[model samples]
Structures are given as structure tokens and as C-alpha cells.
Target: MADKSNKFDEKLPFEAAIDKAGYGLYSYIMTALAGVAIISFVCIVFASTIIVPTSACELGTTGSQQGLLAAGPVVGSLLGGILWGYQADNRGRRKMLLVSLCGGTIFNLVASISVNWIMLMIFQFIAALFASGLYSMSMSLLSESVPMAKRNLVVLLVSSIFLLSQGIMAALAIPIIPLPFSFHLPALGIYWNSWRTLLVVYSSPSIITIIWLYFMQESPKFMLVKGHEEEALKILRVIHRINHFRSKEEFEVLGLQQEAGQEAALTSSVKEQVAPLFKMPLLKYTIIMTALFVINQVGAFLVWLPTIADQFVRIMQTGENSDLNMCQIINTESPVDDSVTPCSLNETSLLIVLGVGAMQSIFNFIISIVVNQVGRRNIVMMVTALCGVSGILVNLIPSALGSAVVFGVLTLGVVVVGLYTAITVSLFPTQLRALAIALAMTGGRIGSFASIQILNLMLVNSCDAGFYLFSSLFAASAIVASFLPDDRRGKVAALAKEETHKNELAIKTGND
Candidate 1:
């Protein structure tokens, strides 16, 4: 029944097969799904910034306790990122994503009913443990689903969605958090207020994401690498049929070319799978990505953007100290007396947060357009260097509006995160991609935690010194970005060549 005279008799590489499948409705839908997954994670992590100040009175939380509550998700992610990555590599991307999303959503729902700050923190922490690896898993699956040419653009589009998530959160929180409704449950000794309602709203995205993922197929490239040739082919055929509006049989890729030793990775232990990244050529990439992550994660300052914006707005409204810098304005803030003060959300601050997210989202979209022409390495260097200069200018300007604009530029570090992630996907093999990304992000989270702590100390002790320190980190990141591969294609080709050599050596030894 086979067409013996068909011109495409030879097997093709997976990337080539993806090209033949073409990009159409399917790629767009998948990229959107990936963006939703990102939103599910982003909303949960950032919801804390809003929840902390709003819930402080009802939860009876002290300053230190509120700090712990704010940090709960970060700590949880720190513990769980590598574990989920390991499972994703050994099992499958789709499975781990489903498992994590479901678990995270369930815990998030439970957290909404929490009566105490400790209860809320613990539940959210557990939720974050489940959600920590969603970003990397989503990126890896998206990377494998599309053709090589569309990979960077689609990945950055999803990153744009990530930036947009902040605005979405602020928009949702604005109306929901200010509602003058409360249901008191005397039996449970708790009040179901706006903050609790906001938590429920935040969990909605994850619930929808889980359902969307259920209809999605496992990565065909993942199956091909694991030696499921028939399964992979079936998925590819469906893709071709949907994208090309042609018969599945017409897809010319008869078989997929698997990377050498990829199937062997199926049986390898986690330690065995991870060891190679530290040994030879991968060592340089691993080290460089870690350094980039450390510096990039300094964007964690955005976590306090709402708080700073609140103080800035208050100062401007009072027409007090009009010529003071950001540090001076922040120092003038009065501490909230949780025991006596009414919990109120600031509208101007929420609007500022929304503006920041919208601006960054636009910037990310612009970056996606230029990335192909400008190159990933170049963009990373250019953006970081520019943001570093902005970081210094943030403290130098005496006007609040000027400083705010510079602060926005400083947050462009978020754009670098997306670029670095796209690079990680191409830099590593399919078998190890998830784990490698997880490791790099874990480093980033560690950096984020340290920077937040150090920034808090510096902001209180020496505000100018704090800004200078982060500016230096951004500068250091730009220097390291210069070392990235001139072209990701060359790097991937070299990795493929190495894998082919290993495969040949294995075959020769078997024959001997």
C-alpha cells in the first residue's frame, strides 16, 4: 500500500518535519495556551503584593509575618522547581504540567478559606510548590511544537502575555479588592472579604488552563526522542492535516531523525541526566545562564512597585516635599497601625501598576519583532546596559514623574528573562531541556530572594547605595550576555554533531 515511487523516501529531522507541518491555527492556539499557563503562575505569585497590604488588618499580621507571607511562594518555588523539572524530563511535559496545575489550583482554592495568616501562607506555599515549574515546562513544550523559525517569536509572545498578566491582575484587583461587602462566618471565626474574593479570582486562570491542557497533545518531538516513532508520527500527521488542509498521508516525512543517545536518556537516573551539563561543552552555557539569571532576577524590585507607587502618590497629593527624590518620598511614609487603621486599597497605585504592565507588554512585543534581525545575544546586552543606566538615573532625578519613567526602564529586565529562556530551549537537548531551564530559573529565584532582602536593607539604610548596587548587577549581566553564542543555530548544530558522533561510536563498539 506504500508509495514506492514517492520522492520523499528518506527520513527527515524533527525540525524539518515541523517545517513541513507548517505554522497556522494550531501554533497560535498552543502559544495562547502557553500564555495562559504563564498567567496562572504569574497571578498566584504577584497576588501576594496586593494581598499583603490589604489583608494585614484582618489577618492581624505583624511586619515580619507579612514579609514571610509575601515570600511564601518564592520559598515554595525554591524547593519545588528542580523536583518538577526532574519529573518532567523523566516522565513528560504535558503530564507534569497537568499534575502541577491541578495541585496548585486546589491548594489555591483552599488558601482562600484560610482563617489565619499562618494558614494562608502555608496553603499558598504548598500551592507554589506545585506551580513553580510551570513556566519552564510551558516554554519547553512550546519550543518543541513549532518550527525553528517561529520558535523565538512565539516564545517571546508568551512572555509578552506574562507582562500583560500584571495589568490583568491589577485590573481584576481594582474592582474586586475595593468591594464593600463582607460575609462573616461566626462558626469559622473568619470574615470572607475582598482579599479572599481576589484569591478565588486568581485561581480561575489555573482551572481554565488545566482544562485547555487536557485537550492538547503531548509534544511530538518529545515522543520522537523517546523512541515512540509511531506516536510521534501520528501527532505530526494530525498537525500537518490541520495546518495544511491536506491528507495526513501526504506528509512527506516518513520517519523522524532522533538525536543520538536520547532514547538512552529514558533509562538514565536524574543524576546521570544532569551530570553532562556540568562536564564539557554544556558547562560554559550552564555557568553563563546562571550568571545571567542572577543578574536578571534583580528585577525582583518590581515586586515592591505597588508599595513605592502608593507612597509616591500620597506625597504628590499632599503637595509635600515636591522636589524630593524617590528615597526621600518613601522615607516620609507613615507606618500603618494594623490594630486601629482601616484597610483601604490605593487607586492611583493600582493604575500605575497597570500602566507599568501595559508599557512592558508593548516593549516585549516590540522586542519580539526585532529579535530575529537584532539577535538574542545583542538584545540581551543592549537592554540590560540601557536599564543599568536607567537604574542610576532613577535616583539622580529629583522629580517623581521623571524617576517613575526611569523606573519603568529598569523593569525591562523582564524582557531579558524571555530571551534567556528562548536561548535555553535551543541551547540544550530535548532530553535535558526542562531540567536545564529549571536549574537556571532556580538560580534566578535564589537571586531574586537575595536581592529583595538586600534591597530592603539598602532602601532603609542607604537608598542611593541600593540603586547603585542593582545598577552594577545589570552592568555585569550585560558583559556576560556578550559571551552567548553568536548564532543559536550554530550552537544547536554543534550539539547535534556531537550527538551523532556518540551514536556512531556506540554502533562501532557494538559491532566490535
Candidate 2:
């Protein structure tokens, strides 16, 4: 029966292959991945704002020291991405995700009980490694499992949930800290700080994800390649039973059968599975998409919208009229003069950040709709150009218009970010998709790390220079984005097959 099913799939058209598999399975997998993606985003964004600020305040660390602490994740993420990507290509997505999530949960727990700043940094780096791995693997699995027609929408939807995680972190940070109970080290007799408490709270979510994922099945595509026909058929039957609300007989009628005697034929090794990714056509797309990924990362890093928003608030308070700059605001040396109402740091700035985050999700939804229609290259170029322009405006805008325009520019910048993110997901093939994304994301993290360091340096002198520096990075990203190719909508498998055929014919002709 398994053999018959495999034969049926081999004979079916590309679209038919998608249709034969149960969409319900894809949906379930994507839903799970989306949850993990959100957690990953929350962990990173939360660490940047809540953890860094609290740790720095507690330790009396300098701006540069804070910058290094902030960059710890990116440093770990770069290494983790390459390691996990190679693992996914070899071991499979489901296994890697579970491993990564479990690792992340343990590391975050350790981080929450750190003895010193050094231990805190080390644990954060370990947590980051797992988080980065989880992120890349989830997206790659989603891409491979979904149909061509629905892939863009699914990828965008799954990725967009990461935005909501940021909001969740913000909401959680307020309540978790200043709690009555805190960890105390008997050896040192010092209670664990609020920052440590926050880490403990944040780490709780990963425990749920880790347990839930253990019950999940492997991707049908991965199973097929690995020659696990019986297991693949079982998964397909379950999916079919769920989707059609019927039994195994109904699933068999739908042509979800395994190929005859293909178990012996299915001898393709892991090396064989990955070798095509480096060959022609696939290799070309990989290079192009990787370059775009690097460019987008550089732009994303420089346009740290949250930090810029903070600076905007400071500038608004200090510019010409107010007596205080950021230092005075932080140190509270002089009582804020009644005549000068310091910009309210409550929901207003938070709302602006939320608005920007929402705008990014909205733009992602828009790209999901139009990506197949307008093509990937054009959308990237246009959005990247807008991003560059918005960065410049963000730098140039005087802080006089009371926070409203600051909010608007930041929101616009986020929209551009969404646009670029959508393009990145669409450009790579499933086999190499996760690794490509990891590399790209890691590159972006590097850019972000550099931006943070630069911002810290400039904050010592002038806040304005940081915004200008960010703008320059976006401008450079736009220049790089213009060179990418369009149209990543068709079947990657079919493309690979066609390339293989062409190569065979060329070799035959050369031999003749």
C-alpha cells in the first residue's frame, strides 16, 4: 500500500502533489511553528529592552558595556544558525526544533539564576543559540511542507506572529518584575534581581512549546527523501482523516499511496539531499537570496526603530527649549521644571512602538497578497527604496512636533521592514531555505550589533549622529536590493528537475 502511494505521487502533476497531501497537516505544522517564532522574537526583543536596561541599571554598567551585553545573542545566533541549518539538512526539521527548544528552555532557566554579569552573558548566549536554531528550522519546515499556491501566505502568516511576541513581552515585563518572591543565593546571600526574575518568567513559555512539539510528526517531504514510506503514509492518512473527516479508506481513494518496490530504490543519502543546493540554478538563487538577506539585515539593524524612538523622545525634551538631555533625564539631577513637561514615557511611546510593529505585520499581509502578483524583486526594490527614504526622514525630522510625527515616521519605517521580510522568505527554495534565512538573519543581527555599538558611542557625544549613521546603513541596503532577480513563485522541485534534465542532455551532446 505504501509502495502504491509513492508511485501515485510520482505520477501526479506538481499541483496534484500538493492537492493529494492534506492541507490540514500543513496548517497544524505551521500553527506550531508560528508559536515558536513568536517566542523567539519575544525573547530577543524583550532581552533588548527589559533585560538590558534592568541589568545595566543594577550593575552600573557603562553604555559600551550595555552594548556588548545586548550583542551577546547576535554573536551566538551567527554561530548557531550555521550549525542548525546543516543539522536540519541532515537530521530533519522536527528533531532539530525539539532539541533546540529544549536547549533554549534549559539555558533561559540557567540565565534566570546567574551569579554574576559574566554568567548572565554566557547563559544568554546559550539561549540565543537555541532560539536562533528554532527560528530558522520552523520557517524552513513551513516552506517545505506547504503548497506552492499557499506557501507565501503561510510563511508570511507564521513569520508575522513574531511581531505579536514583541507586544506580549512588553505586556509581561510590567507585571513580572517587582514581585514579592525572588531567588536568593545562600552562598552569596544576595537575592536575584528583577532582571533575573523577568528572565525566569520569560523562560516559562518555552517549556510548553517543547512538550507540545515532541508529539508532532516529521515533514512528509523529508520523510519521502529519507525513504520512510510507511511512516510518511501513516502521517498522510492521519492528515487525510482529519481534513476529510473520514477514515483510512477515504484517504486511500484520494491517491495517498506509497510507491511499489521504491523502498529499495529510495537509497538517496543526506549528502545527496544537500548536494543539489550547491549545483546550478539552485546555487544561483541561493547566492541572490543570500545577498538580499545580508542587505535587508544591514538595513534592519540600522533602523532599530525602538532605539530611534527613545532618542526622538530625548531630543524632543532637550532641543533648544528644555534644560535636560538624556543624561539629566536618566540621572534626575535637577527637578524637571514645571514649565517644561518632559515627554510622557508611558503608553504614548509604547503605543508608537506597537503601531510600528503592527504596521510591519500589515505590510507583511499586503506582501502575501501581492508577492505572487507583482513578483519578489520589484517589491523588494520599491520597499527598500522607501525604507532608505524613511531612514533619512527619521534622521532629518526636528523633534519639535510633540511625538506625533515621531510616531508616524517610526511606523512607516516598520512597514518597510515588513516588506523586506516578506521578500526574504519568498526568495529561497525549501531545501536550503532555512539555512539561507539563518545566514541572512545572522547578518542582520551583526548589522544590528554594529548599530548598537555605534549608537552607544554617539550617545556619549550627540544623539543626532546615531540617527544619521542608521540612515546611511538603510541607504546602502537600498543600493544592494536593486540587484536581486524577480519571480520566486513556481515549484522549486520542478525547477530542480528541469535543471537536472538540461544538464543530462548537455552531457549527452558533449559525449556524442
Measured over all alpha carbons after superposition, the RMSD of each candidate to the real structure, in angstroms, is 3.3, 5.8
Model 1 spans > 4 angstroms off: 1-10, 246-249, 334-341, 488-512
The candidate maximizing TM-score is 1
Best-matching candidate per lDDT: 1
lDDT of prediction 2? 0.57
- Candidate 2, residues 1-512: lDDT per residue as tens digits? 78877644444432345455556754666666556655754574346555665555455667666677777766677678777887785678888887887787788777877666677778888888877777667766666565656666776676566655555665565554434355668985556766677787787677767776677667665565456656656666555566556435354333233332223324435455445445554566455555545544332332334454444454455554244433223223322544422322233444546655566666667776877767656666666566555544543443445233432443444333444444555554334456656666666666666666666666456655554555555556556666655455564345445544443333233223
Q: What is the TM-score of each candidate against the true structure?
A: 0.93, 0.79
lDDT of 1: 0.81
Model 1 lDDT per residue over 323-425, tens place: 7777877778755534432665677788888898888889999999988777788889889999888888887998877877787888876778898998888
How much does candidate 1 score in TM-score? Answer: 0.93
